[model samples]
Target: MARRPLVVIGSGLAGLTCAWASDPQGCILLTAGVLTDGAASMWAQGGIAAALSPDDSTALHAEDTWRAGAFAGDRAVIDRITGVAPEVVRLLVELEVPFDRAPDGSIDLALEGGHSRSRVAHAGDHSGAAVTTAMARAVRAAPHVEVREHHTVTRLLADASGAVCGVEVRRRDGSLEVIETDRVVLATGGMGGLWAHTTNPTTALGQGVALAARVGARTDDLHLVQFHPTALDVAADPMPLLTEALRGAGAKLVSDGARFVDELQPRDVVAAAVWEQLTEGRTVRLDARGINRVATRFPAVAELTAASGLDLTRDLLPVRPALHYSMGGVTVDDTGRSSVPGLWAVGEVSRTGLHGANRLASNSLLEAVVTGRAAAADAITWTGVWRGSVRPADPATVRTRTCTAAPAASRPLPLAQVRETLDSACGVLRDGPTLQAAVDCLEPHVGDDAAYVAWLIARSALAHPLSVGAHRRTDNVLPEGVSA
Candidate 1:
C-alpha cells in the first residue's frame, strides 16, 4: 500500500511556504478557494520584517518585537523567530520574490510602526502578494506536491488514539472527500471576519481555531487581536487597507486637521488614538501627501485609494481602525506542533508566542515563513516515523454537518448578528459588561464555527480585566481620550 501524504490546510503565505518547503517529502495542499485568491497574505502591503541593515541586529529586532507586544511575548520564541528572519528573506529571494531594491542594488528596507530600524523588505507595496505569489508559483511547479484547490478542510480526522490521521474536505461541488494523512498543518489564518469591519477576507472566520479547539488543541490569547489604525474608510465591504508603510514613509495621522498622536508608535497605541478620535466624532485621516514618490513606491495602496476616489498625493485619506491581525491562536511550539500528535499550525492560526499581546508591524510575514518552514521540517521527520511504523487506522468518522452549521436551536443568531455582537463588544477598547453581553449572545450558537470563535474572543476579553497590549479594557485606567 502506498503511504499517505502529509495534508496541509490553507493556501496563505504559511501554507504556501510549508508546501513549497516540503520538497522531496511531498504533501497535499488544500484551500477553500483558488490559491492565494482570498487569503489575507495577498492583501498584505507592509512587507516582511528582517534586520538586514547595517545598524540593525537580530537582537534589536527581537527587542523591538517584544516591546511592541508589550513585553508579554516569550523572549526565547521572539529571539528564535527574529534570528531566522533575514535568512527567511533570503529564501524568498531565492524563490524569486521581487523585493524592491535601492540604487546600490541592495534590498531596500522600510521602517514601520514599532520597529527601531529600517527592516521591512517589500516589493513595492504589495509585499505579501509578491512573496506568496512567488511561493505559489514554486508550489505549482513542484513535482512532489499536489495542489487541491477549492477544497475546504471542514474537520481534522483523528483516530481513536486522538492522533490526526486524515481530513474531511468539502470540494467546490459541495461533495465531501476524505484524504488519509498522518501529519496535518492548519495555516487557516486569523478570525478577523468575526468582526463586521475587518481587513481579512470574509472567509477567514477562524475555522482553524474552531477545528483545533474541537480536537482538544490548546489555544492561547484568543482575545488579543490587533486592529489596524488606517483601514481606508470607504463604503466597501471588507475595508481596503492603507498600508502602514505610508506612515513609515512620512505620512501623518491627522484629525481636525492636526496631528494628534505620533504615527510611528506601536499599532495598539495608534489605533487607540484613531478610535478615540472616531468616537469623539472627529474625522481621522492619513495624510500621505508629504511622502515623496508615494505612487511609485506604494502602487498597490495608490490603486486602492484611487478606487475610493482618494489620492495619496492629493487627499487626506479617511481612516478608521478595523480588525486586522490576531495575536492569539492555537498554542504551538517553535516547530509549530500543537498539543495533539500529528497536528501542526502555522501562520496567524498558530500562536508561537512571537506576538504576545500584540504583533509588531511587518513581523507577521516573517513569522509566517519561519513557523511554516519549521513545521515543514518537523512534519517531514514525523512523516518518516509514521510511515515506518504506524498502520492506517480504521476509516475515521467524518462530521456530515457544515463546519458553520449552528446547533439545533429556535432562531439561532445569524452570522451577521454574531459579527455585530463582536464588533460592538470587541473593538480598539473593551469593557466587562459589553463583553459579557456579547458572550451571552453568542453562547446559543456555539455549534456554528464563527459564533464559537466569537464566543471565545468575547469570553477571553471578559476574563482578562486588565489592559494589556491590544486587549485593552476600557475599565482599566488608561490615558484620558484613549480609554474614552
Candidate 2:
C-alpha cells in the first residue's frame, strides 16, 4: 500500500514555512482562506528578532527573551530558538524578502521593547507581509508542494487507540471532507480574537487549541495572553495594531500630554500601566513626533491612522491595551512533536516554551519560522509505523489536561457576548470572582469552541492565583520578593 502524505493545516508563516521545508513529496498545505488572506502572520509589523549585529549575540537575545517572559521561559529552549535566529534571517533574505538595509548595505535592525540591542530585521513596518509573500510565491511555484486554499480543518481524526489518522476540514461551500494522513501539522495562530479588544484578525478563533485538546493532547499556559499596549483606540471591532517598532523609533506613551511609563518595557508591564491609567479615567496616546519620516517608515500604521482622521507623525494617536499574542497553546517538544503520535503543532498554536509567560517583541515571528522548519524536518519522514498509542503529555504543570470531548457542533452564541465575557473575566486584569463569573457564563456552552476556549482561559487565569506575567489577579497578592 502507498504511504499517505503529510497534512499541514492553517497556512501562516509556520504552515507555509513547514511546507517549504518538508520533503515536498510528503507535504500538503491547507489554508482557511485564499493564501496569505486569513493569516495573522502577514499582518505582523515589527520584524524578526535575531542576533546578527556585531554589537549583539545569541546569548544576549536569549537573555532578553527570558527576562521579558518573567524568567518562566525554559533556558534550553530559549537558547535553541535564539541560536537559530540568525540562520532564519539569512533564509528569509535568500527567499527574496526585502529587508530594510542600512547605508552601508547591511540588514537594518531596530530596537524593540525588552531588547538591549538593535537587532530586529524589517522591511519598513510590514516585515511579516514581506517575508510571507516571498514564501507564498515560492510555495505557489514549487512542483512538489500542493497548495489548497478555502479549506478549514475543523477537527482531527484519530483512530480507536487515540492516534491521529486524518483531519476533517470544512470547505468554503460549508461541506465536510476528510483527508487521511499520519502526520498533521497545525499552524492555526493564536486566541487573541477570543477577547473583545484584540489586535489579531477576527478569524483567529483558537481552533488549534480546541482541535488538539479534543483528542487528548495536553495544552499549556492557556491563560498567558499578551496585551499590546498601543492598539489604535477607535471604534473598530478588531482594533488595528500600532506595532512596537513605533516605540523603538522613539514614540512615547503619554497620558494628558505627559510621558507615563517607559515606552520600551516588556508588553505586560506597559499594558498593566495603561490599564491602571484607563481605570483612573485617563487617555493614553502614542506620540510619534520625534521619529523622522514616520509616515514613510510605517505606511500601514499611517494608513490606519489616516482612516481615523489622525496623522501618525503629527497627532497624538489615542491608544489602549488590546489582546495581542498568546504565550500558551498545545504543548510540543523541540521538533513540534505533540504527545499524540501522528499530530504536530507549530507557531502561536504550540507552546514551545520559547515565549514562556510573555513573548519578546519580534520574537514571535522568529519562533514561527524556527519552529516551522523544525516541525517540517522531523515530520517529513513519517511512514505511519506507529506500534503504540501516544499519551497526552503536558509537563509544564502537573494539573494540565485535555479537552473533555470533541467541540460541540452547536453554533456559538453571538460574537459580542463571547468577547464581553472574555474581556470582563480574562482581559488585562482579573480576579477570582470575575474569572469564576466568566467560567460560569461560558460553562453552559458545552459544544461551543469560543465558549470552551473562553472558559479554559478563565479557569487557567483563576488557577494561577498570584500575578505573573500577563496574568494579573486582583484578589491574590504575591510575596514582596516575587517578581511579576
Number of the top-ranking candidate, with TM-score as the measure: 2
Q: Tens-digit lDDT track for model 2 on 1-484?
A: 7778888887789888888888656588889899977788999999999999998999999999999999999899999999999999999999999999999999999999999999999998889999989988888887778888999888888899878889888999999999998789999999888889999999888988888877768787899999999999999978989999999989999998888799899999999999899899999999998889999999999998999899887899899999999999988888898877788899999999998889999998888899888889888865656432234544322211233233332556677899889988888888988888887777656367777777777878877888788888888766568876
lDDT of each: 0.87, 0.86
* Model 1 per-residue lDDT tens digits across residues 1-484: 7667888999999999899889788899999989986789988898999999999999999999999999999999999999999999999999999999999999999999999999999998888889999999998999978999999988887789877878889999999999988889999999999899999998889999888876667777889999999999999879999998899999999999999999999999999999999999999988999988889888888899899888888999999999999999888887888877788899999888999898999999898898888989889877433321212211211112344334552344688998899899998889989998998787767766787788878987887888999988979754445664
Off by over 4 Å in 1: 383-412, 477-484
Clashes of 2: 1
lDDT of the structure predicted as candidate 1: 0.87
How many steric clashes does model 1 contain? Answer: 0
Model 2 compared with the native: what TM-score? 0.94
Mark the regions of model 2 whose C-alpha exceeds 4 Å error after superposition.
Answer: 383-411, 477-484
